[model samples]
Target: MSTPMGRNVIALEWLQFGLGRLVAAAAEEGLTIHLLTGERSEYAHELAELDSPHLVVHDVNTHDVAKVITTIRAIGDVAGLLNTTDTWSLVSLEVRAQLGLAGPDPACIRLVRNKALLRRRLYEHGLSRADGSPLADTDDAADVAARVGLPLIVKDSAGTGSEHVWLARTPDELTAALDEARRVALRGHLIAEPYFLGPLYSVETLTWEGRTRVLGVSSRILSAPPVFREEALAFPVALPPAVAADAEQWIEQVLKCVEYTEGFAHTEFILTDDGFEVVEINPRLGGGLVGEEISQTLDINLYATFLDLVLRRRPALMDAPLTPSRGAAHARLYAPRTGIFVGCQGQELLSGHPGGPVLRPALPAGTAVRTIAHQDGCVAVLFATGATSELALQNVLSAAGEIHVRMEGDDRG
Candidate 1:
């Protein structure tokens, strides 16, 4: 692996707050970062802190594809390319391939992009524990549901962040789930699988070549099942060593099957009585600074490592010592109910809490927010780190209790 003289890497279509932190971190490492988003305002302020000499911005939505390509070309030489969003993940692969730059293979990224393709590929490689199939339409979807039996899980074929997922317990529930699946299919296709019930767990890791190393594991707590809405994540998973070992083995097999060559992967799984079943695989850093927080706890710069992988350089990762902190937990805060922008009370109380690890006071006083469907609004996110995963969970829950959300309109529910 060759090392570049300077840090002039590019990040594609940065939008999320995580990307901002990553940009800041990269700049701190003396890396000049470039970004492309639908608009300049989306991430300009975030990039301002870096004051990088090679910051490039392109309007992804309005810019011509050829122009975007030219824009990426104009960024001079890039040591590495990072993408925060899945769409950009694909684009980054293309750009890397065009430049003969190193990153995950674009073809492999395709399999990861579509859940149906991922399941089929994994099954072909004998990496799947549960029998799963892709739903082409309402009929095939229903048939798959019937075969998988009731109490099955239906989700988008290429979905993210638990967009359109659900659990169907009976024929009627299955119909509703199928309908929802079809609706989501209108946006894209759907992937229907047996609802594997077990302690929900996720493996966050960085893979180089074919060697997939387990960075950390988290026993995930979800508000609902099959749908898999992420509620909380507790790291340094409290699982028997053998159980975690098996899960790691499954992850390795899946990565090999999908040909995941570089960078970070957030894989969700279930520890069933028989074995672990893979829920899904995302070929990027996990959301909400999961990699950062976990890296902090373990004293590894996962973000930097990811950059190294993309840059076709060997980070001194093998020699790097892991200092595992006591397990920690991360919880998300959503509005109590759905409504227009009113505001939040007890903001100071929540931030000034004595015994909590608040990553940031994200939600301002009057940020207009809406729920995923108007049932509940995601007003704020609180990540609490503690000595133990259990203690961390308790502190986040307690802090969530401390904050008060103010909303307008009558009770819709």
Candidate 2:
């Protein structure tokens, strides 16, 4: 039996939007969450407001693995931990193993965190797009691009949140992508592989006793081609039950192949004309307010549930069904151009609508902003739940338009 610990630690790198939600969930569950971040983030004030007990904010530089281990030990009796950031997972799992903490197996974590390792494992399990290989150098990238055809994808071996991902169409493009990828690869490791053009989505699941249970699917909206910016996400896909069933089936295989056990897994996949092909799996909740959506609608605090599992507490009984009756849509709001934020226009309007949007904006006025590729300078997020998918989309779009990002930039130029 997994012993449930009354005291828990939430070792967060940064408390932006998602971590904040995790903190709130932990608080609601009557668990103590310790905030851990580097020296630079201004996350303390926001966390202090939560009034969590012994909210020990530590400046454990995640890069220094030694210091991290020391810090974890210092937070004595912190029976279990939950991570809200991707970059911290590798370190967290490593530290957890060293401390005899229970969670997703460390090897499973390694496979999911490293893109190359993930692809290789998925391919071995017959879950990949087709013949693919991890690149060794710029020369290898060019070779793969040619063999895979134009429009190839080059990814970082240990990059998170699509930071070092790129797509190329020609020799020039491939070279440029390789340069950018090399710059962003973690510890300087990169993978160049074939790009699969298709609809992108995420399979959210919670595993217990090795059973991967579905918790709805999210359709991802990308910012632009060749960039990693995720503009939006929606839930309750309109795909027929049969197709969704197939997706669930595929997820089971992925969980087993990757050897993922216990805890949450956010599996990304491309639904192509060929079929569903695996994108890397995240051994945690799908990012971008997914936990919030699940919590609000299904009455499940995924963060709490994760803590419970890690502590070996009795799993939170899900009286509610996983499938949502009405579809929900979440849109990322970014500056149409680039400049310092002057404030969003209609936050009240966006929040006023009862069913229109569940507004969660990370940035407010006076925050410096830019229109960088693969980065949403999101001023706000508009979440809408409606009876039908179209209605939900319309509500979200309407709310998004109402909340305008005021920026000063050379639009004409």
Candidate 3:
């Protein structure tokens, strides 16, 4: 039999990314993970090679928060809880409080999840250009035009991964989006606001006791207008000393405004001609290789700090001086048309390219990709690293250009 770590940490249903890092962090901290997930297959990719001694999976209906709480109470030596998913974060917070474990405040989690409320709060504080107007079921295109104006974005206030988000430049497009919103179910009510114009970037930070550290910024390369889908991302984007300092100061204020006491935050913003405008603040690490990529870039496992927070200890990251020794980037693999995923065509070509590009598959073969307009159609991510952000981005793009996603019905591959 192997040695045992008597202490245990709780992980609610997690996002597909970052489980490996979280598991390693737990082990290093002398705490095994009691993962309460509704579906074990969601983590199949990571669990295959995981340190089995450090993690124990429990199947429970995470959606049913009451049942989730009861399950946690039965798990022995459960000292703290952590969750990176938008779907289960709230449930985790509730369970933490019921069990008397250290965690983020309940109100703070709810406020950040509601985009409309966050926009209004920031607008009141002059951090945003305009407040988002609530879209009622009875409201129409003209109502939105009069309230938030045209060229607006209509989105579910609680949406994740760019799902259920629509951009309309014309009144006709706005009408169509509104009609579609009526037909579909939303996690939260619809919210409309004037679209901020500029490139997108998400600043990853670690916070404790109202103090924050600006880890690094990731350049979000999104698709062309009408759809807000992510395409690629490069970390540690070069910024002037003053520009970087401004972002740091603004992020500190934003955190204070939300009364966020602790934990990681991935704040997405638009760099407009006027200045940086608040987009949405995710109360966890950036999704999909963002945590892993940044850990490599900084030469440190930031997830270690996550466990530190749950144990109610000062996160070492808060005191440590970070030096980003390398750069990293990732590009999404997209199929030309909606069909069943087979594999990639030119992955072999990546061995000849720079940056040491690695292809990470999100979906297994035979899985169907029904659409390319959103994140679901992104079959895999191609990650690469270099000495600088520009070079890493260049190498990733070059390697990605050679690889063509092979779909069942798409002939282009």
Candidate 4:
């Protein structure tokens, strides 16, 4: 089917941060954006405040796939469907397939949603060295530990944001991790793999009209183990020429193996002594302002580029080769412990500093706080840019140090 021209596009589960940008992009291109989301989304009021004729919000239980499809069909003439959040990718694929819109094959998308399946496909293609196996709920923890060995990572098969991911260094820890995994597994299944010891990185890519291109790479700073939370990220980080080439090659091969021929992908992996150990590939841009950082440093609107791909129009960024003009970094701030939220201080100090970071606070004053165990618990994100990677990273760090969150009922000083 040919792509629809300047028609309505349906976005599954619209929220402020990323989906807002996409909606604005669509509106700018003369396309109407219909945002479908659950009734309870916190950003519902914010979406209403857009007050644009090109944007509309529809409330439905996003988890109810059948009801969602019915609502979309009732609305009629949805030209395309898009989803940046992991929870909505499959739903978007199903909706697009049903609406005869442009998107990757649902089967191909399954390879990304299912972690164990992805790892198996990579191993079959000789693209990864990590060993992983599907775990069962009834399996004995000790026996499973003996089989997979100690110092393993356990996580849900379809989890997102590293939630429910646990690192276990002993049999007892394995049991505890398994219990936690069982609580959060959407499909009641989990996977166990040897814990990789190396620096973690993510490669962002964009595919259009059967061709894929590497957009950029970001180095990750993960919080210490037990639970993995990404604390900071720096993009356009320099890599050895040979290593960069090989990593890009590996990403392309993996895309082929999964038959992912369209859309954006954020592929995470660990740089080991031998080569890249495949982390799960996400079928969207990196979370936490990575796309915004990319747009600022590379001078391209990724959200607009994504719309181009969906409409089957060639993206202009692809026409001319582009590179990062400046280094960019993002750092997230979390509460030190569970308490009653008060406010943050030292914003004035960083506000006038050269290369100061752009701060985005997630919570308001008086909200209850909790000990941050995962990325979802972050309260604010800070983004900064500089002439070089080291300088950008330094700016973000210095800015983070100047800011401090005060909470009631917490005494960690």
The most accurate candidate by lDDT is 3
Ranking by TM-score: 3, 4, 2, 1
Query: RMSD per prediction, one decimal?
Result: 3.5, 3.1, 3.1, 2.6
> Candidate 1: where is the Cα deviation over 4 Å?
4-7, 39-59, 62-64, 138-142, 184-187, 225-227, 351-355, 359-370, 373-377, 408-413
> Which regions in candidate 3 have their CA more than 4 angstroms from the true location?
1-6, 410-413
Best by TM-score: 3
lDDT of each: 0.66, 0.70, 0.86, 0.78
Q: Backbone collision count in every prediction?
A: 0, 3, 0, 0
Q: Residue 308: error of model 2 in Å?
A: 1.3
Worst 10 residues of 3 by lDDT: 1-10
TM-score of every candidate: 0.86, 0.88, 0.95, 0.91
Q: What TM-score does candidate 2 reach? A: 0.88
Error of 3 at 45 (Å): 1.9
lDDT of 2 by residue, 1-413 (tens): 84655476656564354555656666676666666678523453355455555356777787776887788777777767677567788778777777777776778777777777777777777788564557775465447766667777877777766667778878888888777666652643767666888889898888887777888787788877777787777775667889988988889988988878777778888999888887777777776667666665565555667656756765663333665667677778877767787766777775567456866655656777755564446666678877755566667877777777777553457
Which segments of model 2 are wrong by more than 4 Å?
A: 2-6, 18-29, 39-49, 54-56, 138-142, 183-188, 317-320, 323-325, 337-339, 351-354, 408-413
Could you give candidate 1's per-residue lDDT for residues 1-413 as a string of tens digits?
Answer: 57765466766765344555455557666776667667664443344554555355556652344555676677776676667566466666666667666667778888888887777777677676556666666464458656667677777776777777778877778777777666544334766777777877778877776677777787777775444556677777666788767777778877888888766788887778877778888887676547646765776655666556655776556346655686666666665555454655565776556336563333444555655431124445667777777777777777767666666653356
lDDT for model 3: 0.86
**What's the true lDDT of residue 327 in model 1?**
60
lDDT of each residue in 1-413, candidate 4, tens digit only: 45676387777874335556776788788888777888534464345446777777788888777888898888787677778778788777777776667777788888888988988888888987756889876776787787678788888788887777889998888888787777753642688877878989999888765577888888898988876898899888788898889877878888888998887889999888878887889988788878877887888777887677667777766665667899889888887777676777888888776576877766666767665787656777788998976678888988999889778754565
TM-score quality measure for candidate 1:
0.86
The TM-score, computed over Cα atoms with residue i paired to residue i, of candidate 3 is 0.95
Model 4 lDDT, residue 343, Cα: 71
